[model samples]
Target: MEKYGVEVQEKKQVKEEGLQELPGTHENIVLRFAPNPSGPLHIGHSRAAVPNAEYVKRHNGKLILRIEDTDPKRVYEDAYEMIPEDLKWLGINPDEIVYQSDRFDIYYDHARQLIEKGAAYMCTCDGAAFKELKDNCKACPCRDNSVEKNLELWDKFDTMDAGEAVLRVKTDINHKNPAIRDWVAMRLVDETHPRLGNKYRIYPMMNFSVSVDDHLMGMTHVLRGKDHLANSEKQKYLYDHMGWDLPEFIHYGRLKMEDIALSTSKALEGIENGTYSGWDDPRLGTLRAVARRGIDPRTIYNLITEIGVKMADSAISWKKIYGLNRNLLEPIANRYFFVEDPQLIEVKNYEGGKVIVERPLHADHMDRGNRLLPFDGSAYLAKSDIADGVFRLMDAVNVDIKGDEITYNSTSFEDARDLKARIIQWVPAEDNVNVTIVMDDASLKTGLGEAALSDLNVGDIVQFERVGFARLDEIKDNELVFYYAHK
Candidate 1:
């Protein structure tokens, strides 16, 4: 289950430290996973959610689920609904759901107070104008407007056109980073928000809403992507200016690489352009895709735990993830029979009787017991395994096939002992049982006609006979069912 490169010895030391008792009583600490409702969450988001949830659980604290739906135009209904479900699928439960769109008045009230205190001002410069002006350029004429005039203009949100002007937090333009230099706090948006209809016009940006909410909600510790480390400094500045207490900031590295794009906008573009099937495409590192691929949440959690809280950025290979999943599922999965590309074989010279052969449901585990399989003097086997004009039948006999007829050379069953290549799976071809297996579109190509077993009820995990572990998605009557398997 170890995905990270950390040594087992080191992990034991860390685990021992984590198991030690805390020096003080647990505080009423609150951590948050503030995902923007712009697109489906990818695997990078899972990295954050897993650790934050684990930390909260370890310390007996609260994990708040916050939807940063500040962008009116970009917010999607599906994104908001799927986020909580995805987190729950990963075993991370939140104590409360908070939407930034619901607190526009609070953001505005604080924005206005900053204006009254001469800490913020309205800027009429558009994007092009600001880009041309740059840092050395003169401040817009509206920057010097009286706070009373700004308040009067702010109240006219109902009449203002979108992007006509914006409220900017007052910061030194000469600051090292341009983001700290009078960043926009709020702007008018004419589009309707999915959650909050058209009740308001102006919306707060990430810098504004995150700072205000984190302080108000009493978030004692913040764990976020490393890209926000610089933004944290700006937030710290805001807290200092407002005489508010600041929280301990922990910035972890992002999971990214040149080939992989974690951006929601990029993912949407891929979906639209047919570069990917959907957000849950197996090729994409999204939580839904990982879950659908049968990777357990415990494995994902263990990977993050092994990686620990490091500031260095790293990209994980897909093989490593799959390997960990295989390890976690190996001991628990059962064994069964599955014959793909089945070829029928008819017995020619039998002793006028049907012979029943039984094999245990699980190998090396007697508790699983056995199932009766009808067999005659002959049995169908996979055609691909036959080689060089010779066929081995469980090593007990050798057969030659010519013109749909198989000729056996040996008659003793003892000769088949310990024949690894001869071992194969079989199902009753004469049986009337029917099963329909549902798989991701990507896997459908290579997995066709491979004894796909799907006759399972919901919540049932059955061995795919010999293929792998499969869980029943849904079952209709006793004939048809849909199943998903873990590789």
Candidate 2:
């Protein structure tokens, strides 16, 4: 085998056994969403996961969820379970689930084969020296080491200190991409893996292990970010050497959202430092955070599919995303009145007894039914919901209020809509229910909601008439807690 030169592949090499193309049938495809168990799935992950899961479904194929838990240092105990839960919440179910830590023997077997074939060697070069060589496109002294010596060093993973040895694949040292030159296939990690503990010190580097797994797992197509194109090329060397057919590669561009803290490191760091509540903290960009802020999973699916599998990076604004969701929510979300920063005003001509008021759950969706509110002598209104003049109390009779003076007017919905009256939301004092609205910014707004809100269960999405759409989080005692989604 010539060092730093492409090897001639066997002429009659065919696809692996069991992966043979069927007669009069299509190639059975398999897709995957491989997320390392380091953190919960973020919106950026959704961009990757949605397409993989969607393609498998459309093609009537399989979607394997391979947890890239090979990096012992980055793995977290909670994330192993949390990642799957987040995916389940988003309605993405994997056909097969695998953990890399469980497949160490498989990776080790493949690594040994490469070493025996003189296709890979163990290099003892330090980080600084390797950087210097990489900078100058110079091959390190260990690049010419004998196969027997490299195999001896590779077998010493149990005794060698971490970073004492690295198993490097044979590649062009003068390759245009410095990062691609003789890529490390395996390295000794000192850290105790969350799942594997210190049971294994020899860890297979990403491309080496991924190539092995994809071939053995029968992955037919790989749909991933364009950033992984270089990785795909590097992995191809392993496939061609092992006489495995290359999987169909469909690389899409990155999807970045404006104002979102997309870095998993920063988000996880914030959580650990008490800067964020958890993975679901509204300040973070994780899918749990988006759901906690009341964005629907169905909406997320539609958002990603709309972008499709593009070649160019897609930059999106949160406003556009919420605007689309608002349209989807309006028809289904029940309407209620909630008065925050509540100001009380006395209805001057009101009788002592309460006046019954019927408010429709949805003005256009009559099938949603109505809720009844009672007005005695006073009404609660949001300070921002009213002007200094007469306005129609939404779904009820017209009310004239200047400063604190409040007087009743006509009971015509036609007049309110026709005159383009300023529609204000109000909760009669008798029908007020203490409520807390959690805004997307993580602030809590205390308000008084219509008592009818008591019928709403947790997870129900409701609109606060003139306010915004909010998802019910909880109800304790007489108070209703909601997560304000968007208008």
Top lDDT hit? 2
On TM-score, the candidate that comes out on top is 2
- Residues 1-487, candidate 2, lDDT per residue (tens digit)? 5632434444455643321222222346787899878788888888888877776666677889999998987887788888889889889999889999999999999888998888888889997898799778998898888889888887886698888878888777787888778889998888888888889888999899889999999888877789998998788777876779988877889888889745888887888899878888776788888787678888888788778777689987888779878988888898888999998877676554566888788889887787998877678889886666667776666767777677776558887776567888888877678999988878899989988999888989999876799989888997888988888
lDDT of 1: 0.68
Q: Estimate each model's TM-score.
A: 0.83, 0.90
In model 1, the worst 10-residue window by lDDT is 444-453
Residue 157 in candidate 1 has what lDDT?
54
How many backbone clashes does every candidate have? Answer: 6, 0
Candidate 2 positional error at 181, Å: 1.1
Q: Which stretches of candidate 1 lie over 4 Å from their true place?
A: 1-26, 257-284, 347-353, 389-405, 409-414, 417-421, 432-455, 459-470, 474-487
Q: TM-score of the candidate numbered 1?
A: 0.83
lDDT of 1 at 32: 90
